[model samples]
Target: MISVKNISKTFKLYQSPSDRLKEIILHRSYHRVFQALNNVSFEVKQGETLGIIGENGAGKSTILKILTGILMPDRGSVNIDGKITGLLELGTGFNAEFSGLDNIFHNATYLGLSRNDIEKKLDEIIEFTELHEFINEPIKTYSSGMVMRLAFSVAIHADPNAFVVDEALSVGDAYFQQKCMQKIKAFKNNGGSIIFVSHDSNAVKILCDEAILLEGGNVVQQADPETIINTYNFLIAKRSKGEDIRYQGDDTSSGYGNYMVRIDDVSLQDENNNPSEILISGRPAKIVIRLAGEETIDDLTVGIGIRDKFGQDIYGTNSFHLKKKICIKKGQILLIEYYFKEFNVGPGKYTVSVALHTGDTHVNECFHWLDKSVAFEVVAGGDDIFIGFVRLKPDFHIKSETGNKDD
Candidate 1:
């Protein structure tokens, strides 16, 4: 288990080497102070994975460094119940002149393993990396993905009670990355604690029990993975405007925009044109949206997003993508309906999110954006029984041929 409390860090930026010398001799400050972290705190318990997400310069690296002992905090404290290992920046703690095989022993020793222990685990670690043929090559000759394989292999095999993973995994190929994810899941199942930092929301939703969002050296929000990811996306949309962004909605539903166009009502309709919370798979359906215009907008776009119960985005589209243009005038009410010839989604619970904005995306001019505005379930109705999230309507055929054995 790992615990952190109100930790902060600051760095002094100097203009030049002369400024540092002058400050020491004249007893005057000549550098600007940048606060990278401000009273940030969180905890990871055994068998739990906590995800840390934020934009660049949000103090993510600073906190990770402090936790791993690479940097000391200016205030607050950190406590760890057992040994912790970290996979930080790419190629960190490695010798460019050393062969990959040599670096294994080098890193294992630094992790406090005895020489005998390293020898015992060496074969297993090498096999996990799948780099048996290239293990003798110098580190400088290895690709980024190869270096990640070696580093991750060594870090996991160290057998620490907790692991701190940074974005180094992003450099690995898809196959190796999936292999690492499986190993991390196994570690979590065995009661190991983890602090996972990544910008990939899908991975966080799949692997994390909870998540935290950081902004400008502060902890903005901490909650379930779904909520945190939604909040993160909202912040990203507003980041360009340099506004003081904050979550403005509740746990069940969230929304943000300028209120030029408002979603007055949203509903799902079955083939019979009746309001419904349940829909049949492979049947006709439609989504009805009522909009009120508070200000005249020459260009407007309507978007819809469908998400599974786990908060994974299944499908999304917008009027802009469909090549449809809209214009609303003040005090005008418009009713919009999107008809589906056949809703091909699999049987599952899903939520519908709606958005009104200018252009194709909401980032430029978001008039309004609502998350989980309506919830519905799809039930199996056709003759086919399928598994997973979508129905692809597969067509299959088979033929038998007669031929000589040596044909």
Candidate 2:
């Protein structure tokens, strides 16, 4: 268990040596202060995996460092009920000059493992990482991926009560990632607690039971993993739209993929093909997505998601699920319509996003088409009192009237 209360971290930025010299030389009192975290707080129950997410410089790593005692907060406290092993950064808690084998022993000891205990698990760690050939080599000579594998192997093998992980597991190849996921699942299933921090939505959806969204060093929202990821995607969408409100590094763009896909429009209507903004709960609704292909797309599949105003994904559908082929010619215009019963969804404004993905690949081939277009709301005047993204009412009745005697 972990409890963070009013945790805040502040740093001082000095312009130059002269600024510091002047402060001491002339006894000046002026100083510049930077607030990294401001009154941030959260609680993680035992055996819970809480996904910590935020934009760059949003105090995500800061919180992790504070929790692991790597960095001290300027104010507030972090109460951790058990021992913690953190893989916050690559090559952080190891001796680079030492051999991988030596560093493994060193790191294991740092994680509170006795030399004999570490020796007992040494073969398992080496086998899990598949780094036995390079185990004797200097850690500095190891590649980034190799080092990450060794580091993770040592940490998880120590069997700590709590885990603090960043994006460190993403360094290795796909095979290693799969192994790490399996290991993490096994660890959590064995009642070990984990605090996973990452920007990958899929990882959060798969591993985390709950999540917290941080914005500008503040806690903006906290909820289920699906809701947290949806809200984070919405924030990313706003940044991509070049909205007026900008967070740190919002203007920076990365060369993600060779090709990019964008959604032009999203509409919802009835069977008559007439566009209707409002829909009654528990009715059938058709969602139409219009997408434009900027380049020649081969074997393209579209994945669509519907989310509420709070950024909770109510439903997700994709063409791949239907085992359909998507061969779009160069600069082709396409319309994709998904029909489903709109049951269990509460009344709220929702946004629809469509992603152009390569067939059979889990990764989205194109830049995520998140919050591409906003749709209208569904009123909650139905008899069911369910409050969720969808409204599904299952029928339940007595099978035999004779068996059901009148009261």
Candidate 3:
């Protein structure tokens, strides 16, 4: 098992090397302190995976380096029982001028594997990487993907009791990445402890049983993988806009529209009628919307679209699209509901947006419209499974035709 107790690290920023000498001569401070970690704490339990997620300067890499014994913390302590291996900062242990095969032995030994251990796993590592002829060439001549394959193969074959990885899977081709994920899954199933640090939220949600969110050198939230990832996205959205998105009910929703009609309330619910910002994939999606006509409504059409985090349209339909025009006078109220029996969409964060407009010609003449009025998420579940934003289940069977003479 691997554990970190209130670990923290800080660095001194100096203008130049002369500043250090001047400070020593003057017997006073000449640099500013920057805290990269602030009393952070977490642990990786045996037979489980713990995911650490954050932005570039959120101290995630610092934690990983500490776990791998590459860096020491100025404060706090780290506890470990068995050997720990890490796949971090790819291409670090490799000599640019050395051949791939030579680097394999060099790096694996650097990771604490004995010559016998290396010999036992050497063939499997080379075959898994599939570098074949290129394995004899200098690492500097290999592509970024080949380097990843080699580094990852060496790290995994070391077969430590505990492992630490920092975005190591975000390399190579899609097939190779999947292969890595499968290997990680096997490791987990075999009772090996893992500390996975990555920005790929979907992978975190799928692989990690527990997760932690970090911000500005502090522990923001730590809980189930889905909730932590959602909180991280919310924090990112706030940072991206230079403002905090106001949340009325634990959901960060924001939008704008015209001056005529107004969207009063919007929510996403399951078939049980329980409201939540999360929807299970392949389950029913029940959407409810209430609108109020603030001004006179004339020649108007209203539309609703479920979009992914990128604002790409996932599913959309409108009263106008169905030829069901909504004509209401000023001060009137409107209530609308949509039910989807099988919301077979893949896992992802989604938002429901609404728009009120007029004219059949070009969708101009806007009355009121709110983009991303209600934000929600879709999680994985159900039968045939795969990756991507959309899910289409396929059937498989073999049919046979018997001869006319026999039955």
Candidate 4:
């Protein structure tokens, strides 16, 4: 369990690196103070999980550091009951010169483990990391991912009563990440508390019982995981309008969002799950859209369209037309995938258009619209090809002129 009351953190910023030394030597003011947090308060109870969602520079990391005592807050009080283990950074307290095995023991010791206690957990840690023979190698020689493995394994095995897990789960492969999530769930099920901080709203929803939203170094809101996540998403989208100005379109594309929601990213994948901007004719194709909204959306309609180079619309459909209602909360990334059994396209260039809107037949309800969002070439294969926009796999009957037709 953890509790913070009226906590604040401020850092003095100097104009230059040398100014810091000058100020220290002169004992005068040579810097301006920047507030990293203000009146922040939250609690994580036993057997419960608390998720923190915020943008970069929103003081999410700053508060986590304060909780772990990696940094001291300039104001307010923090009271924590039980040992706190943080997965804030991978290999954070590791010594590069030490071997993986040695670093494990060192970290375990720091986590309040005795030599005998570490020895008891040693084999399990090594086995979980799958470092194998490399466990004896110097940590400096290991890849970033390998170091992460060793660090994560040791931290999780330390068995602290409360976990301060940041976004460190982004490391390693998908399978390994899933394994770590499983362990986190298992830990919480066994009466452990977690302060889970991440930008992933869905993960927060799935793993946490409560959530907090941070913005401009302030506690914006703390409430049900879904509500907080939705508010956070809306704030993020609103923020992006001013800070994110990169082109979301190309020569054959155009895009615009209504600030209600935005398509963050899009991808084309094959049946094997390999991504590409091109598709092979008659092969399975997938369109994956990464979507986020400003607030809770209950009647969202997601649509996708395919068109030829000449702007001929080949196909288009929306969730509403199919009688499927899509509901999502803010900050939650809706990774919607549309799977097509076959491209059925002829060799040529085509563009994919996608949109998110409300009110089935109302253009005014368009929250976001993208045209030619992703352009791809459908490469024709096989000698039995015809000239058209698509392949129908036609069935035909032919009779020779000199021969009589037979029924």
Candidate with maximal lDDT: 1
Per-residue alpha-carbon lDDT of model 3 for 266-322, expressed as tens digits?
888886879988888888888888878888877667778777765456687877778
Model 4, 63-166: lDDT tens per residue? 98998889998889988887888788777889999999999989899889999999999999999999999998899999888887888888889978888888
Query: Stretches of candidate 1 above 4 Å error?
Result: 242-247, 399-407
The lDDT-based order of candidates, best leading, equals 1, 4, 3, 2
Evaluated with TM-score, which candidate comes out highest? Answer: 1
- Compose the digit string of candidate 1's lDDT tens values, residues 80-128: 9888887899887899899999999999888878889999999999999
Error of 4 at 312 (Å): 35
* TM-score of every model versus the real structure: 0.93, 0.64, 0.69, 0.63
State each model's CA lDDT, in order.
Answer: 0.90, 0.76, 0.79, 0.81
Candidate 3: C-alpha lDDT = 0.79
lDDT per residue as tens, model 2, 146-237: 99999888888887788888987788889888988898888888777888999877688778888999988899889877666656755654
Q: How far does residue 71 in candidate 1 sit from its true spot (Å)?
A: 0.8
In candidate 1 the C-alpha lDDT for residue 279 amounts to 96
